[model samples]
Target: MRRPTIKDVAADCGVSKATVSLVLRDSPQVGQVTKQRVRESMARLGYVYNRRAADMRSQRSQTLGLVVTHLRNPYFAELTMAIEDAATKSGYTLFQGFSRDEVPQQRRLLETMAEHRIDGLILLPAHDSRPEDLLETVGAGQLAHVLITRSVRGYECDYVGADNVRSGVLLGEHLGALEVSTVAFLGGAEGSSARRDRIEGLGSGLRRSGVTSPLALSLPAIGDEGGIPLVDRMLERIPCPDAIVAYNDMYAFGIMNGLRARGIVPGRDVAVASFDDVPDAAFQQPPLTSAAGHPEIVGAQATRLLLDRFEDPDRVPSTVLIEPELIPRSSTTSWSGRA
Candidate 1:
């Protein structure tokens, strides 16, 4: 029996061969409805796209690689999905790797992707990553690359990330307005640039609001489980802080749980705010107040930057910093400072 081809799919969908080709490539030129119809036809006819043959003819793999710090973090998960969506629209397949914020693991992932010959790469640098780690593959231009979420020290590379300092300032100002005398920052890795920037901005905002000093603590781990023990330690301090700012929503959620275990109410007794207003932030027990990092924007922009790099390899590298918005919620409201 003869094998199904693009022509057979085109004829079945009542579209031109060119149109069928466009659909196969997932071109933006094709309307969604038409793409859906063409896909249906292809499925019904068992038409398979010969991507390898296409790559051979184009001398390109039409694939992009993405390496994220932590997929368990909701923010990175959403960011990855957004990048995939953008890549698919541009006729590129996206390959993903999670480094778990380990420099060695991240380096391994980059080499593996280069071995696979992906056309481009987008990376969220792991904690404590140095420029040398990326200079070999990404800096040497073996593959087009864009850095997202975090940038490596001394690496002059294209980057897209949230304006973390501004996000921290916003959160700090919000907490200050509540007339809280003391603030404690919890969670996140100590080596993370984003964490440092957030702390700086938080302290600046707190000082501007007449709050003298802010306490900061970096957890060995950053998720909810790690956050549970943090509350007790903070409470042990002289005149326990009146509010808490978490590195991310997960920390805030865990801290809230810890607070409840000790019969401390979140909003009324001690306000809680966090960064990365992930999907679950709103539905938490007291609806967390958080900075909307907009991971989708970061992901989409990172993909766009990488695509542009492919078009003009010699163009000057660029950096994009998306400003964050504060989402006020029940968790940070109705605060009555400690007695």
Candidate 2:
């Protein structure tokens, strides 16, 4: 069977190929009557408009690319969903890829998006990716790229994320109000802006409440695996911390599992608090107390920012910092603090 071509639609609509092309592209220049006629002809002839071919001819792809460090992480999942929703509303489709925290994979995905001529990209860079070329290529190609959940220093680009430092500070204050002396900090990885800001904020909050030189710990970047070992080591210490502040809810969950294995009940033996109030946090045995990172707002705002750049390439880069809110649940109910 022969495939129907644009010329067939043109002939059936009694219009030129150019008119049919414009109508297929949904160009506003085509009158409503003409667009309706061309569409009706296409439907009648079973002629499908080739978007890829049209994009190749026009040198403009209408697709958006989204790359994240870990899709398994609920926070990233929420963000991706929001971005997809906004892209659909704006007549654009999204192509998503995950790096699994691998820098090489991230670079490969970036190249793929570029090769496909994706209109824009939203990236949550890998924890170890510090390449200057990454930003250079984005700037040189004039691609609209927005950083979500993470930001690179000295890069002039649009970014949307929570105030990690403030979140940490709030957590520290909460612990201090509970008079939780000898607190410990378990974090994602060193050299990550998110980790640095969170630790700094937590330290400041603890200091302001008269806790000096609180024992801070940095776990290996092996996600959940690192959390168990770190907690085991902490248990061996003579004077264990009465309260544990984790980098995120995943780490907190790991800690809870480790404690359970040691016959220690979390929220009772030792209070635990973490950030990023992912859905699973609420369903945990004792329900994790955490800082709400608002992934949906971050995702929606980042998508909007990138689209704005697409509309006006000359627009100035912007930064959006969302405030984190503390959710107190059973995890810290036993502690001496306001419920």
Candidate 3:
């Protein structure tokens, strides 16, 4: 049998096809009585609305696209969940893509989402590439876009991220408070905004306490297995570092493993601290002292910003920076009953 259509429902209800469309969309413009009548007619005629077609006609997909660099990273995973929850609550659905920290992949994903007519995009850029080109494409396609966790260098866009600099400063101060003279920073790619800001903040914070400059070492991207070799190199240095600050909990874990292989216990022999308080940070041999970025808060804020852009395309882009907190654990303690 032929599927019942909006025309059939309209005919049965003695109303225009437009009325059925409005009723299906739950538009407030349609009177409650009329909506009930249309629904009854739809039920009687077994009518099913074509949501995609309706969305196309209305020029609003009511869907949001999310692009993240690494799906395996706990921070990104938590952020994804928070964004999904907020999107669903706001009567929108999410489509996610993982870019694997590659710029080309990120660009391709943005193009694909734009082609699919998503209402808006929430992107965690792979690096400091100007997103204006992508944003212009989305705008030309009548879609809205926002940046989350990572921001474009020159272009202003709705962005939600933690104050990474502040977090770094806090970490440095914590280490300085312990009077650890020599410290090393490990992990993160070169030219990464998070890396640059964090290192600067950490150095400045340490300087505030009259501590000398801390040595920094870059580790390979997350899960790249380069941390093993990097740790080996650090160990070979004359007079190894007294303390280490990792880019994130994952890197800290790798560092800890490397320390163990060298017969050096993390907390007792050399103190360690990092960022992103992932669940594992708390369960490590000696719980990790780290800076916590509330991914859930960032995700929700990003969703709201994107939704606002979708609602008002002409609104100016805004930047929202959430502060980070420190989670002190056993990782930074010394045998002398000091942290």
Compare the candidates by lDDT and give the number of the best one.
1
How do the residues 1-339 of candidate 3 rate in per-residue lDDT, one tens digit apiece?
999877688779887554566688887767899989999988888777677876665777778899999777798899999999988766678999998877778778888988887878888887646656555555456567778877667766688898989998998888888887778877876657888778888888888766876654434354354445558867675455778888788888988888889888888888899988988789998999989999999998888787666434687789898999999888896523244
Candidate 2 lDDT score relative to the true structure: 0.81
TM-score per prediction, in order, is 0.81, 0.80, 0.79
- Sorted by lDDT, highest first, which candidate order results? 1, 2, 3
Per-residue CA lDDT of model 1 for 2-102, tens digit only, reads: 88876688679897655676676677878999999999998898887787856653787889999997777899899999999988877789999988788
Which one wins on TM-score?
A: 1
Give lDDT tens digits, candidate 2, residues 187-295. 5877688988888898888888878766555454555355677687776754456788888898888888877888877888788999999999999989999999999
Backbone clash pairs for candidate 3 read: none
Candidate lDDT values, in order: 0.83, 0.81, 0.79
Q: Which stretches of candidate 3 lie over 4 Å from their true place?
A: 1-57, 131-142, 216-226, 335-339
Score candidate 1 by TM-score against the native.
Answer: 0.81
RMSD of each: 8.6, 9.7, 9.6
Ranking by TM-score: 1, 2, 3
